[model samples]
Target: MTKPTLADLTAFSAVATHRSFRRAADALGVSRSSLSHAMLALERDLGVRLLNRTTRSVSPTEAGEALLARLAPVLRDLDDALDAVADARGNPSGTLRINANESAARLLLKTVVPLFLKRFPSMALDLVAEGRLVDIVERGFDAGVRLGESVPRDMVAVRISDDLRFVVVAAPSYLSGRTPLITPDDLRNHDCIRQRLPSGKRYRWEFRKHGEEMAIDVPGVLTLDHNGLMVEAASDGLGLAYVPESTARDWLDDGRLVTVLEDWCPFIPGLCLYYPGHRHVPAGLRAFIDVLREVNH
Candidate 1:
């Protein structure tokens, strides 16, 4: 009997972890047919039916589950060992996958991305902009970027920006005939543009004044998942939008959108780069973090 090679183990573990050949193939940057062939070959060599497949889903059999339980940790340790060697070389060269929200991605692109790339030309960055929070480790990402307060307590977080502020703004045309908004409650009577979270829940507008905080579920004619689109909607006279002030800066500066209720807007903790505390920091991630600190400072 021949021993299973590293490639075979990696393929099996990816499929087992995701429970979907298509997802595993995508993650591995391989074709679905190729992944299927690898798995079949692995099963043939092992002489066991390791996976139970159906039209809708795939799950590992008992033998496969046992194998997976052992392989995951071992693979992580092997990768760590390789990373240690790479670190010894004093140069970062590899793909650094990051999962970040739209706002964070925009902030990084504007502030640090160009400099970071110039400083580390050999390193590749894969930035996935998402509206929802994701488990970076499980998703095979090296790190994630999100508001400091939103980061998981178990992860190590590094501040990448100062406080962020939200603002309520609308085009002059939209507010021409409507009553001016004086308080948070006044938003109820206005045609506000709302944001829809990844969980399908609408984001409520939050306000703070003199230590008092209020969250309002503003009535809206349009709801969008992206802040840029929300700003555009407000600029087009669709409705008032409560968005990160940075997102609406250009429109506000150009007199296309006017801000209201500035005193009520709160400055929240800024975005942070976070990663699992237990894993060894790869050279690429370490270099990226250093660049982030340099640019932010």
Candidate 2:
């Protein structure tokens, strides 16, 4: 069998790591079609099928997974060695992958991402936006961003935002015919657009006032997974939604939606960018954190 080139090995690893050619290509700054062709050529040259591809998904075969198990650490070490040389010169250069929620990612794009890119033009970043809180270490990400309250205890977190509040909101049309929402208990008399947690459980609406706290499994026929979607549903008069106050601000301003039970909602912890405390922080990641601190401060 012909030996695979270094580029081939790295491309295969990237595809397997991302489980999609499109994402892998974006990470590598290549086109998906070219990446796909490279994988086919690499597999043919090695006389082994490394990837199982479908229209919607991709997975590494057993042989591919075994090769990746050994190859990944070697590639990571190679990157670190190269980055170390750059770091010595005070230049952080390498791919920095961050797994982040949509909200946090948006916040970073507005405040942190541009500055980091402009300052470290030689470096690259892959910010994967999703709602689920994933295991960043296992997923091969340099870091992850999430709400401070949701960050794992073991990781080192850099605060990116201040306290935030989640409020209950409904369209004025929906609220007009319903019983007055003076307290959390009155939510049971109306339809609530329930939020589905990442873990496949419905998020219980939480409320607190004075010394009393309540978690309500709100009544509703419709359930949505995203806060943005929940806010849209509430705006459409489908049902009431519990969402970030900032997310509902525009709708509230336009008279499409109005807040209820405002006395119950309280400010909670803000967003954070977190990483594994045990591993060596990549130079690019450290640089990014510095930028975060500078911007957020």
> Against the true structure, whose lDDT is highest?
2
Cα lDDT of model 2 by residue, 13-72, tens digit: 999998989878876779999999999999899888999999999999999999999999
Could you tell me how far off, in angstroms, the CA of residue 151 lies in candidate 2 after the best superposition?
0.7
Q: In model 1, which range of ten residues has the least summed lDDT?
A: 85-94
lDDT of 1 by residue, 1-297 (tens): 568999889989988998989878766778989999988888998899889899888899999999999999999898888778877877778788899998789888998889878887888888989889988876778899999989999999999988999999999999897898888999988888889999999998889999988999999777898889999999999998998899999999999999999999879999999999988888889888998988878
Off by over 4 Å in 1: none
TM-score of 1: 0.91
**Could you tell me the TM-score of candidate 2?**
0.76
RMSD of 2: 4.0
Q: What is the TM-score of each candidate against the true structure?
A: 0.91, 0.76
